[model samples]
Target: MFRFTDYGEEDAIRLCKELVRIESTDPGSYEGRISEYIYETLRQELGADGVRLCRSEVLTGRRNLLAELPGSSAPAGSGKEEPALVLICHMDTVVAGEGWSEETGGPFSAAERDGRIYGRGSCDMKSGLACALTAFCREAGERRLRQGEKAPEKYRTLRFIASVDEEDFMRGAERVIRDGWVSASDWVMDLEPTDGRIQNCHKGRVWFEAEAEGVTAHASMPEQGTDAILALSYFICALREEVAKLPEDERMGRTTITFGQITGGYRPYVVPDHAKVWIDLRTVPPTDSRMLRELLGRAERAATEKVPGSKFRILLTGDRQSIPPCPKSRLLQSLRQAVREATGEEAVVSLFPGYTDTAVIAGTLGNENCLSYGPGKLRLAHKPNEYVDISDIRRVMRVLRCLLREPLR
Candidate 1:
């Protein structure tokens, strides 16, 4: 067998193909075996030159890959010194969906057709990981100088963090955020698939659950006990109506609410005595999660008033997303300039509809001087035939490389 890293650009396509070959289908882990392959490749093929692998302490169920390349021992960032930059992306994809395309052999089977690399997660995220790693390696190789030789006066470091658990739960981002694990990097760049546009803002997320309890009563004797299903249903409808009334802002888009999950009592002979439901909400900027806590409180009250015989309670217990607003810092301007120069396209800045690890780190860092962009196409993510254009991959690689050489403002 041959190593994928030793091959040329043509070889990288095949490497991606091989990656798609793994049946990573929810074997209790999102990254599956492919992440382990990348981890091993980074350690062996990429070699020890400037690469440091740090495992994720928060997510031992799945691991995070943190790689840092120290540019120089210089202390300051680009005003008089260049500041360090961190590149962030995730490693997990949503669990495979059923009724998938047969030709792709259930999503992981990578197939090449008409200049596209086809497979699950090929677009949603895995390709962006390749883009960042390739840029880091190419930049390092190009900047090497002899012991006595002096390279350019650049004095910044670059860190790449490949995270896990971004699909179902955001614990990966939450854990890192709570720990303040990142060294004070001058800035953060989330490499999400944006079709080359810079993603500057993203909406915040909230996940909520409600439970209704009632005394069990036989189907033949309805008057003997209360029905929990009635109580829960009342809350569900009222909550949905309230969510529809959530305020909408012109810039960040409207608030969104969805009934993600619901459950009721079992067996046909007995009336349902207990029920629960999960609600997920997306908020425009400035809509604090305190709003959700209040909303749940209101729903509990509404259910109790509607159904006296039954007990009703609600809990807002899930990972909520922190917003990273559009930054106006010099580093942001530098990035935009590099992006425009590389693509000849003006950047379109907007908030991401989904959550990411960058939000966590940015929140803990206590600032909005952060930004995220990537090569993965957003529409095809987690869909039937997920794939990323090879051209986008090369274009982003060039942009990241150019960013290393440009003088910071």
Candidate 2:
């Protein structure tokens, strides 16, 4: 067992500041430097064989770093191995837009004041990354040393995955699966910004684009040609009405729909012949991928019925599965215990409204033993002047220390 004080507050805050300084924003930004930093740190702590980089397929030289802490030793003569525990942290941050210079210094300033670290990725993720990395180091340090060291004790193997592209297509998560870093029996924890709550479940999403086709004509005579934009509007209305009727989930609340983007018409003078609407459908349990696709088909059919001669096609973008709430599990119990030990109160469990890479890893790795728990408020992520409470970061470290106290069996 390890002490909760093994990793201190000062070191955690310092590392978090260092991570926020690295501009790993998405869309053309590369996670190479941050991944390298994590890899180098883990390699130094766990040795060369214990850490490796899982390169991304879409991004050149981009990689997801994985580190393993095999503990001090293995269970004696059991022949059966302990279930592995995996910790996941995303390395990318959203694009830091304007209006951040004077208000919060800058997106990458890593400025500290009044017990908060202000920066672009500070709250959204860097804080979580720091927690995961620090926890990994502490666990690895538990192994028996060679020089003047006592006999090693057995503990479950621990793994860390610093993934990339979480702000976009999630290719980094796919890379981990391709590299075979995850296993079925492994328990996974995604260190997302949760404001000290334990998120055992989250709503999923089905993203797709629907294109409406129509006949074009001069703007002077609107009746002479079919307006694709008008047809798309009809479809959107019908979709909203249909989604409003879907049964609400007790935990996830409701199946929400968002028209993220719409594009049509080259100029005002001509009636556009084609229009496309990007739809984001938040899903819950009993509403699997196939059901969502069918619902889209029905919505399209309803739109065609409302506006004759308007043909449409739904192009699939993504379908992330909704994670079921793990209300009763040893890991969940352990997490609650950790929270109480750290803060003298039980963890507030809640449903995550946004999609996370946990779904992708769980689906691909064939393990539902995954959840999210960490520091920072969920609302502050991706906003201007983003920041995470330094106290919350320290509290998270204490909880992690408690959770990592003993090896999983």
Candidate 3:
């Protein structure tokens, strides 16, 4: 098994700092600028080991820059084999709007202070991405001595899949599937900011819309028209009560529903006849979504029973399932070893409360053997002044290197 202490600290810090300087966020302002930066860095700096760039269809100016240094003791074509372990990282950040004055100069301006790198994506992902890069780069560098006719036939392929658009739509990973980039592999190691924890579970979302129709009447004539707002409030309360009782799963915890938005009013002089609200449902396993439709029927009945003249309707605006706990016992055990090799401490793991692009990989790939590891504190994701631990990046880098070099038994 490979260990975390194998990789150099200086290398990890360099990769993280350079990427942080690019400010690659949502619809990265400098898409070409950032992609080209990687291209030049690897092609020029590590070209001796043979680095290749793979363009993606997701971002126009950007691309999934892949660097592969043919392993020593690996089959000729084995360098691109299935069930292959991939180092996944994104090249984008949320909008850096505020709370970055303490950083270099602005939100995108990265600063290293007190061992933490301060910036927009410093904590959310850039750190993890850098870790993956460092480990893979070391392998890339190691290839210099293993290339040509003397290279070994048994070797692990270290891939650096740096993509774009993970901040918003996750179009990067989506495009990777559409174009069959990683389809050959059973699973990919999603390098997100997990505070060096292994994540294999997360909650998904179901967006629905509920409408309450009411009659309009003059405000002065209280008995003339129906109050849609009042009807909506009553409907909301019933929905809340019904949603509160949703069953819970041991892995993802209890399912939940919340009223995200509501708007319905015609005029100040008239009672609102139209009221609509958006309901968001966080689902867990064994909880069938079809049951929600049944709940809607009950809600309508309750509304009708409460207000004889009031009418209601429900629509399934959106439906997305949470990626269940794959928890591949063997894979987790292997990863635990990797984590130990990557960090001196025991691997910290838990279910990710929110959603992740891992859903895409889990669906397209296998789940049982799937595992996630990366740098950056998840608590900083999507928040202002998000930063990653510079030292943490190096630590994970060391771990990734060992994982790639570890021989298949």
Q: Is candidate 1 or candidate 3 better by TM-score?
A: 1
lDDT of 2 by residue, 1-409 (tens): 1123445667778888888888898964668777777777665566654444334444786778777766434562465776677898999999988777575789999999888999988987989889988887776665534324564456677888888899888888887777877776677888898887888787877898999998888999978888889889988888788778777888888888999899998789998889999998888867766876777788888877876788998888888888778777556787888899888998888887887777687666657677888789989999988999998898998888888875444
**Per-residue lDDT tens digits of candidate 1, residues 163-189?**
777776767666655544464455777
* Backbone clash count for every predicted candidate, in the order shown: 9, 0, 12
lDDT of 2: 0.80
Q: Give the clashing residue pairs of candidate 2, or none.
A: none
Clashes of 1: 9
The parts of candidate 1 lying over 4 Å away from their true place are 1-12, 23-27, 76-81, 145-148, 151-155, 175-185, 319-324
lDDT to native, each model = 0.69, 0.80, 0.69
TM-scores, one per candidate: 0.88, 0.91, 0.81
The stretch of ten residues in a row with the least summed lDDT in candidate 1 is 1-10
Off by over 4 Å in 3: 1-7, 24-33, 45-51, 59-65, 68-82, 97-105, 148-153, 209-231, 258-279, 300-318
How do these models rank on lDDT, best leading?
A: 2, 3, 1
Model 2 RMSD in angstroms? 3.5
- Give one digit per residue, the lDDT tens place, for model 3 in 25-112: 6744735666777667666556453556566656567676777554434354655443556667777777777655544556665777
